[model samples]
Each structure stands twice: as C-alpha cells, then as structure tokens.
Target: MLPAAAGYDRGITVFSPDGRLYQVEYAIETVRRGTLALGIKSTDGVILAVEEKTRKLQISNVTQKIFQIDDHIGLAAAGYIPDARTQVDHARFFAQSNRLIYDEVVDVEGVAKNLADMAQQYTQYAGARPFGVALILAGVDKNGIGLYLTDPSGTYIGYDAVAIGAGSEQVTEHLEKNYRNDISLDKACVLAIESIFMVSEEKTGTKHIRLAVIDSKSKTLRMMPLEEIENYSKQVQDKESQS
Candidate 1:
C-alpha cells in the first residue's frame, strides 16, 4: 500500500507537487488487480481475448469483458466491471448517433476519443472520481483494422498489440517475442488465447476464455464460440509440442 501523500490524493481534482493526479494513479491500481484482457492486431484482422472469473459457484460463468459496440467495432475491458459497462453503453450511443447523423459508421479512433474525453472530465471535475478500468477498442474501418488502448486518465493510443490488468508484464513479453505484422487472423486468435493462459493464476480452459475478432474480409465483429476456442487451444498445444 502506498502511503497517503497528505492532502494530495484525498481529492480527485488535486494534483501533487510533481503534477501527478494521485487519485488517477490509485484508479489505475484497481485495473491492475482485475483479470487480464489483451488485443493483437494482425494483417488480416484484430483479435481480443479476456479472462473470465466467477466469484460464486451459483453464478453464471459467461464473461462480460468483450462487447460489440457496432457491427464493426468491439471492446475488451479490464478493471471495474460496472465502470466498463458504462463506457460500453457510451460507445454504443456514439456509434448509433454517428450512423444516424452521418450515414456512416463511427471510426475506431472517434469512439475511443469520445470516451476518453468523457473519462478526462471525471479527473478535472470536483467530487468525481476517475474510472477504475482500462479498455482495448478494436475495429475495422476505412483505413483497415485498428487497435486502441485507453486508461482511466483519459489517455488513449493505438497499438499493434497490448495487454492490461494482472500479469500484463508476462503477457506483454510473450507478445513482443511472437507478434508479427503479417500474422493471420487465425494465428492471432491462437496467440491471444495462449498468452492469456500463460498469465492467468487460475486454470483456464475454452469455457473460461472469451474471444472477439474483426477482419477485413468479414468487415464484421464476432465472438468465437466455445467449441472454436477449444479447437484453437488444441492447435496451440500441438504447435508447442512440435517445437
């Protein structure tokens, strides 16, 4: 636990002597405690994967980390689930509004930028706390497949690959060594699943992983069925054994 820096972190609008928002830093810590969520952008498409955890045995095991913002846009979030849901709702609204007003789908960066603007407001406004989550937005747009990462501080950026939440360091290392610009969508999906498995503390299987993909050919966003995820996991294992 970090020692309270006396009068600096108590308020969201207060900045420390070094010009850091302690509250935002603390909100980022909340994201670090959540299960891993990762995205990989390849030549053919973008793949997003997330770890699913059930707090109770009686609860459903379905994961809510991956959401379809529109036909061509998807998001994966790590951190406070409720905050993530709120952001997803905002993204959906923006996408629909863009279609209605402009007669075209919202660009990938536009969605991210709008959400970041909303998040940034919380940090500047009095009595409002920063969101305790991080998001990875992936989509297919006119320019091609795009992958973006955003944090509670309202900062957003594009990435070829990214990992957030617990065990991100390990997953990031794996991606650095294996990720390639020309990797196929199928291979990217497998790589994402494998990377998640490497960092998860709990034993995860196909049933515990959620995957979404956006490709140029399909021009649509879709989540993979459990059976397909299982097959991909097997392929990954087979390739590992061969080497």
Candidate 2:
C-alpha cells in the first residue's frame, strides 16, 4: 500500500478522454516541514505588507530562501524556516511550471490555494511532525487585489490583507481593532508596519525586520525602504514613550 512497499507491484496508468495515461508520484521523499501562523484581509486594493522575522542577531537569514517569486506577491513567514522555504519553493515552482496557463502571470490567490493544497498533500505523503509552515501571500491574483494565508497542513484562504510570523496572535489583535472593510492601501500599510512593530516589541530578542509588498494591479514587489522603517521605528518609540 502506502510507504510500506518499495517498488510498485504493477505499473499504474490512467486514461484520459482519448485513452492517455497520467503518471504522478512514483515514490515519496521523507523529511517533514513546519507550520506558520498567517493572517490576511482584502479591504483596499492598493497595498499589503509582509513582515518577516528571524533573529535580531541571527547569524543565518530567516528569509534567506524565500524571495519575491513574482510581481505583486510577497511572502512573510514565521516558525520552521526550512519547512516554510520548501513549501514556498514548491508553490513558486508549480506556478512557474504553468506560467503559460496564466498568461505569464500567476494569480496570487491561486498560488495561495495551491500552497494550502501542498500542506495536505505533504501530510498524506509524509507523516506529520514539528515541521509545519504558515504563509501570508499578499497581492492581486487573477481576481483582484487580495491576500491569502496558508498552513503546513495544506489549507489556504483568500483575504483582503494579511500577516504571518512569531507575533501573529498579538498582531491579529492589533488588526481587529485597526482593520476595516474600507481600509485603503496607505492605511493598510501603516497597520501592517505598526502591527509588526507591536508584535516584535513583545519579543525581547528581535530587532531588524524584513518587509515587502505587492501593489494592487501590478505584479511587482517593493520592499519597504530602510528610511521608512526608521520613520516607523521613531513613531513606535514615540507612542511607547507616550504610554
């Protein structure tokens, strides 16, 4: 049956409408992945943010493996870096492989759903473990400006805005109070940066951060400039000092 047997006892074949055989998954690979907590919303169709965290003094990069695979779509991660990288890589590969199917553009929402599917498929093929990953994919998909949150177990959701990483719980709390259906890109961006700062502040050993976003309509990713971060940091400091 499953994973127990080495070679296939018989050649597996499937027939299409014209008697065609489709082959998939001869054998499975070991090594499981991890999970991430992702959040998202789609209030405004202007901009969305992806906040990444590793270590304040991290020797190795947390975002080392993940890159902007396409325009208008950025990834933010938390928990099980390697596993998250694998799943994101897999999603990128899958989308690229079928680029033509999407007219040289992969729908961010579609990509996100595919990512969720990945988690389930992985679980079926490999036994579950600590290796789990959560992803927040933000950008305009085939539909419109949107956001998506995916889990290690292969579950995906479309949203208007999103967040992912260590401070998800605290960040979510920040969103509920700030997010609204009519929020604009500028407002959403501020909320994201602010939420991240709020979350990261809770953790003692975090400093430098990576932030990126996919503007509405276009598929290009723009990383938030360091100066922008400095401004936000200043604001954070001022608000904290006020409190």
How many clashing pairs per prediction, in order? 0, 25
Clashes of 2: 25
Model 1, position 106, has a per-residue lDDT of: 92
- Residues 1-243 of candidate 1 have per-residue lDDT tens digits of 455477898899887888889999989999999999999998888989999876556454455899999999999999998999999999999999999999999999999999899889999998789999999999999988889999999999999999999999899999999998889989999899888778766544666688988888887988888899999999878887898
Worst 10 residues of 1 by lDDT: 54-63
TM-score of 2: 0.68
Give candidate 1 misplaced runs (Cα > 4 Å).
1-4, 55-61
Stretches > 4 Å off in candidate 2? 1-62, 126-131, 201-207, 237-243
The deviation in Å at residue 116 for candidate 1 is 0.8
Question: What is candidate 2's local distance difference test score?
Answer: 0.55
User: On residues 1-243, what C-alpha lDDT tens digit does candidate 2 reach at each position?
Assistant: 544332432323322343321122221111111122333443445443444445556674434523565665667655556776786778678767768565667777778888777665654442333234566676666677766777654567766554555555666777777778877655555565567666553422223545555655555777666677566556556666798
TM-score for predicted model 1 compared with the true structure? 0.95
Model 1's alpha-carbon lDDT is 0.90
